[model samples]
Target chain A: MHVLRPLYVVLALAVIMLIARSFWVPNDFGTHEQGYTYGWYRQSNVEEWKNFTVKYRGKEFCGTCHAGQAQKLASAHHKDIECENCHGPALFHPADPLKLVLDRSRELCLRCHTSLFYPTSQRSQIKGINPDQHNLGLECTLCHKPHEASKPGRRNR
Target chain B: MNRRDFIKLAMKGTAVVVLAKGLDGIFRPSDVQALATPLRFVFLVDTYKCIGCGFCVKACKLENEIPFDADVSRTWVERYVVTSEGEVFADTPKEARNGFITGQIDLGRGKFKDIPREKIKKAFFVPKLCNQCEKPSCVQVCPVGATYQNADGVVLVDRKWCIGCGYCIMACPYGMRFFHPVHHVADKCNFCYHRINHGLRPACVQACPTGARQIGNIKDHGDPVENIIRTQQVAVHKPEYGTNPQVYYIGLGEEVR
Candidate 1:
């Protein structure tokens, strides 16, 4: 009878814990077939993360409206670069700001073009110049037409 | 039949039934289907091709809504300079957003000194982001169960549930996690989960003009990135930790940790 009393107490405690867990834990808190490899978590968090909105809409989104600029850019040396890199994010553009401001600053151009010699790496392959010696205090766009890369005798070493 | 014989027969019947039920569970068709096509995402970084232009860093900030002026970044490029004397120096000034202009080496604690270009025997840039390991220590150490790896293998944080406990940030072997300035929760790269789900490249991958960064679904049969990962002799960071990092690097230098 004494041994049986301890067993009865444990049984009662288990029942109480089961009921408490049912009330405290959320309905969606369990392992699902979808993400079963990783153990239990709030499954709805997966959907929340998946549904996050993307701000950078890529160059294809820009090409839809700016076909002329896109076409010109495709044939230029800067073809690989996305238009949004210079113009900033076009989040609901034409509906909000009506115009995306263009950054024609030399600093923008120097971000890639400023020479820092790294002989062992492939970065040396890029045509870089010492910013101080290469037309200091002047916007690169003033002398170079970024979109029109085919222009003869306009290439800078 | 005798009582003992009858009892022995009943026990045999119960054992046979239980074995059959267990076998059915093991070979369930739905379970097999789920296992066959589990999505595994992998990222490849070509260290040789990375020019450290920092466009990726700038683009990631704008895309993810992280403040441009913020010191922390989701992804950043580090420049390594190995001297002829076997000394290694590394720095990521402004998270490589402005690009590497000067030859200064960051010695930490608001101190900087220039490394003479003549002493530099080898130099390269390595772009880094969250490894999104198979066994992410961040997920394991999260006291609130806020950080978890999704079906597609990206480790994500439930910002709402996060208690701002820095356990995860400390647990990460890669030092990838950081405190979100605005949300005050642990934040790290989810491999740009939001964009990748929509068939779009991650902001950093898209902004990389040099094609140094790439990502792909390893489960897919003909993915170019996966093909490269399979065919090439790729290396991962800190393999000794046994975290099973998914990020692969090509032409990784000995100087890179």
Candidate 2:
């Protein structure tokens, strides 16, 4: 009976080790120690986001490379906005170039760009964005370039 | 006693008149929607700065991967030509054709550049996209709940849920919604929920070379887009339709006269 008791104790010890390992360390799927699949996903806040960080909408970077563009963009709605905000996860910027995920769509623009709409006003003559009539074979990039403002004339600057 | 009672009744009658007047304001339909929790974002289109360059059109095509040739375009920018005599006309492509003005490299320069100062009556280019109508007609007519107004007041379509029933296409007075050929479902501008919730601006706003497209949170007092609209006398395209569209254009000129 005493010998059998020792065997049961050893089995119990092994089981305890297994349970402890689950909490104390990470497995292939990830755990408290290993966190999420993506390292950035493990982060808890903007600061913890690791790869992506706000450099003040990168206005300062623009200031260093293109001074005039920084001046013009600084005063617009984009003044407080960060470059990574529109460009998406720019974790591998100049180093990898290709990793720059750009978010481009009219729907994204409508987020904050919707203020100009006032349908009930007495003086409001137009009805909506009227994608058909107003925008003449052109696009938003024709005039506005938030990141570099690299228009043909301003490209060198 | 009689004189005292008569004076009291007169005072009571006056109070009722004043109360009736105050109640009138409650019943008046003066944008009761504003009282409803203001939307997360407000969209603004600065008509004054838009030069009809078609950049928005090209960008939309590339970003959304819309077919190069489809009569129903998800997005396109056109030129609105208003003459001196007050006749307005928008020169939009009749079909979803591409490679327009490829050789035309005069990026809104020369010829009419002088008109901003003198003889030109009112010739301006306004880039247009989906208004994401607040009271979107698209939502009302969708046989399946494919199209709906999101909590933010932006109209969106669940492509997977859509049965390709073109009811929403006809319901929309603005004609912003369209059917996708490959997916065989309804599609339109979703305001890029992918980037927006992640704290990023839309592509058109970022790509705009002229600062024409401005986006902001309209409901918040702190948002700049709200101030831009408040200070400027912006107008919509078809107010008579009553879609309560969110896209606003400042300095709207003559239309299709």
The whole-model lDDT of each prediction reads 0.83, 0.54
Model 2: CA > 4 A from native: A1-157, B1-38, B69-71, B85-87, B94-120
Cα RMSD (angstroms) for every candidate in the order listed: 5.7, 17.9
Q: What share of the true interface contacts does each candidate keep?
A: 0.55, 0.00
Docking class of 2: incorrect
lDDT of 1 by residue, B172-207 (tens): 888899999998999998888988988999999999
Q: Please, what are the lDDT tens digits per residue for candidate 1 over residues A49-83?
A: 87887777888999999999999999988898899
Candidate 1 chain B minimal-lDDT segment of 10 residues: B25-34
Error of 1 at B31 (Å): 12
